[model samples]
Target: MSTETVIPKVEKKHLENPTGGSKMEKVPGKPFMEIHDEINDEGQGNFPLILDDSVETQTQEDVKPKRMRKLTSGGQEMYEKEVEKYTAELIHYRKNLYILINSYYSGELETLEVRLMPDRINKELSKYQQISEKFIGFLKRYRTAESAREEATQKIIFKSIVSKAKTILNEIEIKLKQAQLAKSFATGRKFKPPSASSMLIKQRAKMDAAKTNLRFASKEAEPERLQFKLEEEELKTKAELLKKKVEAKLQMELLKSEKEVAIAETEFNAVREELEMEGSRSSGKSMASVVDPRQHIERYLQKQQEIMKSVYINPQQMQPPELNVHAAPFEPKSEDIRQTNYEINNVSVANELSKFLLKKESIDVSFYEI
Candidate 1:
C-alpha cells in the first residue's frame, strides 16, 4: 500500500457548451479530452472538427470564435424585444438623417442662418433659368444670322461667276464667228469683195501706178509727176475759160435780140397810133376810098393805074367851107377826135392788105360792074 497521487488534466472543449452539465461523465483523477465534431444528424465519419480538447494541453485551434448562437429560450424573448427597440431607434435616426439631407438639398435647412434662404435659392434658380433661356435664344438667332449671311454670300459669288462665264461664252462665240469668216475667205468661194478702204496701202499704191501708166504713156516716163499734173490742171483751166468766154458772147447776143424785139414793139405801137389817128380823121371820106385803100395801100399803089378805073372810084366830096371874110378858123371837136382814135385798126398793115386781096376774090365782081 504505497501511497501514489494521480494528476488530472483539464482543457476547454466547446466554448458554446455550458460550464458544467450533469449529462457529461466526469473523470476523477485522469486527464480527459472533449472534442466537438461537425457531422450530420447520423454522426458520420470524415466530418469537419469544429472543437477539440486535449489533456494537459490547450490549443488556439480548439478555441475558435464563431457567430453567436440563438439565446436561451427566456433570453430569446427579451432579446427580440430589445432588438425591436434598437431597430426603432436606429430607423428613427436614419429617417432623421435622410430628412436632414433632403432639407439641405431643398434649401430648407438654412432657415436658421438666413431666414429666406430657400426662397432666395428658388428665386436665384428662376433667374438663372430665365438667363439661360435668353442666352439660348440669342445663340439660336446668332446661328441663324450667320447661316443666312453665309448663304447670301455664296449666292452672290455664284451669280458673279455665272455672269463671268456667260460673258466668256459670248466672247468665244464672237471669236468663233470671226474664225469662220476667215476660213470662208480662205476657201475659193466668191465672197463679197473687200471695201476700197480695206485695201492695203501697198496694194493701192501698185494699182494706182499701174492704172496711171496704162492710161497715160507720157506718165510712164514723166520726169516730174507733179509738174505734169500741174500742166493738165492748166489745160483744164484754159478750156474752162474758153467755155466761159463763148457763154458770155452768147448771152450778149441774146441781150441784143431782146433789145431789138423791144424796139420793134415800140415802133409797132407808134405806127398803130398813127394809123388810128389818120383813119379817124378820114372818117368822112368814103370807106372804099380810105379804109379799103389804107388796108391794101402797098398792093393798090402797085396796081393803082390798072385797078383805079374799076375798083377805085372817086368818093363824093362834101361841100367846101364858105370863104366868108367875117368867119374865124374852125376848131376841131373834142368828141370827133376821141371817136377817131377809138375807130382805128391796130393789126399789121401787110397782113390786112393780103386779107383785102383775098376778100375781093371772094366777092362777085360782076355785080359791082355796070
Candidate 2:
C-alpha cells in the first residue's frame, strides 16, 4: 500500500456584487441612492461614507442640546453677509414664482420671467443638496469627538443650514399663495366657485333691496308722521295747562301747611311759657316755706326751757331726816317678825342696794296675833 500525499483544501466565498447584488450583472438604470466602500489606509471608505447613521446616533447621545444664544457682533455680520449672498438668487426666483402663480390664478398669459421659476427651484434644491453633503461631512467629525460642547456647536451650524432650507421652502409656498391671492384680487376673479360668489352677490343684493324698501317706506310715512307731530303738539299744550293748574293747587296746599306749622309752633311756645311761669311760682313758694332742721330743733329747746322755768321751784335746803338705821351685824331672831305694813321707796332704797337680785322682786308678810 502506497501512502497518500496531503492536499490543502481552499474554501471559496460566494461574494455579493459591488452594489449588494448576488451577481455582477449591472442594473438597468442608476439607483435612487448608492453606497460603496473601498479600502483606505485606515480601512475607512473611499466612496462617500455612511456617516449619518453612526453620527446621528452618537450625536444624539454625546451632544449637548442647543439653546437660544444671543448673537454676537461678528455673528450678526456673518449672518448679514450670508443673507446678502443667498438673498439675490432666492429673491429672483421668488419674484418669478410670485408672478407665475399670480398670473395663473388671474387667468393671464404666462411671461418668460414667470415660466423659469420651476427650473430655478430645482437648481436651488440641487445647490442646497450639495452644500448639505459638505455640512453632513463636517457634522460627522464633530460627532466622532467626545467633547459635547464642540459637538453642540457643530450641530447648531448644521441645524441652521437645514432650517434655512426649510424657511426658504416655506417662504416659497407662502409667496406663491400670496401671489395667487393678489392676482385674484387684481383681476377681480373669485377664488371660489361661481355658486359661492353668486351666493355672496345675492346676499348683497338682498341687503340693498331691504335698504331701498326701508327708504320708500319711510317716504310714504312722512305725511302720517307730520299728522302725528301735530297731534302730539296739541296734546303737549293741553298737558301743560293741566300741569299749571295742578301746580297752583299744590302751591295753595303748601301755603296752608305753612300756616298750620306756624300756628303749631305758636301753641308750643305758649305752652312752654305757661309751664315756665308755673315752675317759677312753685319754686318761689317752696323756697319761702323751706325750714332748716337745726332751726326747728333750737326753737323746741327754747320752749322746753321756758316750761321748765314755769314749773320748777327752787330746791329747798332741808336737812336729811336722821335715819335710825341700826347698822349692827345682822342677827337671826328666834321668831321672825312678820310686819305686814312694808313701804319701800324704790328711788332711795333701790340705788343703795348694790347687789340687787336680777328678777321681779315682791315681798310677802303676815301680822302675827300677839
Candidate 3:
C-alpha cells in the first residue's frame, strides 16, 4: 500500500506560535498539545491517521465568526444572544450537576459514588453554588437594555462568563474523578463486619475516658468547693466579730452616759442642800426681832387720845403728871433690834458671796465681815 501523507487541520488560533510571532489565542477547551498527546497515545505512533481523523471530525463552522466582528457593526447584539444561549446552557448543566450530586449522596447513583470527605464535598458544593449564583447575577446585569447595547461592557461580560464556565467545568471534572475513585474503591474492596474485640475495645476506651473525666472533675472541683466553704465561713465569722464589737461599744457608751448622769444628779443635790441650809439659818434670826411699823404708830395714837381726855377733866392741873408707859422686859431696844436685823441680812448675803469668790482668802474675809 502506498503511504498517504496526512495534514492536520489546525485552527487559525492554534496555528499562531506563542513566542515566534503574535501571542497565541487561548481556546476554551483542552490544549492542542494535550489533545495531540492523547491522540498519539491512542494511535500508538499512527500520527498521520489520527490527524486525518481529527480533520474529518472537526468542522470550520465551529469557530464563531460573530466574535470576530467589530462592536460598532451590530456585533454587540449577536454577542448578547450568544451570551444568553451560553448562560442557558450553563444553567442546564448546573441543574443536572446538582441533581447528579444529590442522587449520589442519596445512594441512587450507586455506580457513581463520591469518595470525597463529606466536609470537602460540602465546601466544594458551596463554592460551586456561589460561583453559579455570581455567574447568573453577571448575566442578568449585562442583559439589561442599557448594558446590553454597550460593546465594551459586553466584551467584559463575555470574558467573565467564559472564565466562570471554565471554573465550573473544572469543578465538574474534579467531582467526576472523585466519583470514579469512589466507584473503583467500592469495587476493589470487600466489606467485613467489625470483630467483637474491636467493639469491646471501643466501649472500654469510652468507659475509661468517662472515668478519667469524672476523676478530673472531682479532683479539680473539690478544692474549689472547700475554698468556697472556707471563704463563706470566714465572712460569717468576720460579720459576727464585727457585730460583737459594735454591741460592746454600744454597751460601754451606755454605761458611760449613766455614770455621767449619776454624777450630775449628785452635784445638783449637794448644791440644793447647801442653799436650803443657808436659808434656814438666816430665816429664824431675822424673823424674831422684825416688827411691823404700822403697829408702833397705832400705839402712839392711843397714848395721845388718853392725854387729851385727862386735860379736859382737870383743867387746874395744867402740868399733867408725866405718863409712864412701861415696855415688855423681853423686848430689845429699837436701835439694837434694827442693827441685829441688818447683821442677819448681811450674813445671808455674805454666805452667797463666799460661794462665788474664787480665792479662799476672799471667801474667809467675806464671812468675817458678816
Best by lDDT: 3
lDDT of 2 by residue, 114-158 (tens): 455545655655654455444445344433332234335445434
The segments of candidate 3 whose C-alpha lies over 4 angstroms from its true place after superposition are 1-193, 282-370
Tell me the spans in candidate 2 whose CA falls farther than 4 Å from its real position. Answer: 1-145, 148-215, 218-227, 230-240, 243-370
lDDT of 2 at 219: 96
The lDDT per prediction is: 0.44, 0.44, 0.48
Candidate 3: lDDT of 182? 95
TM-score of 3: 0.34
Give the RMSD in angstroms, all C-alphas superposed, for model 1.
Answer: 42.6
lDDT of prediction 2: 0.44
TM-score of each: 0.22, 0.19, 0.34
Q: Rank the candidates by TM-score, best first.
A: 3, 1, 2
Pairs that collide in candidate 3 are: none
Task: Write model 1 residue lDDT over 240-311, tens digit each, in one string.
Answer: 999999999877766766665565556545554555555656554323344444444565455545655677
Worst 10 residues of 3 by lDDT: 44-53
Off by over 4 Å in 1: 1-223, 284-299, 302-370
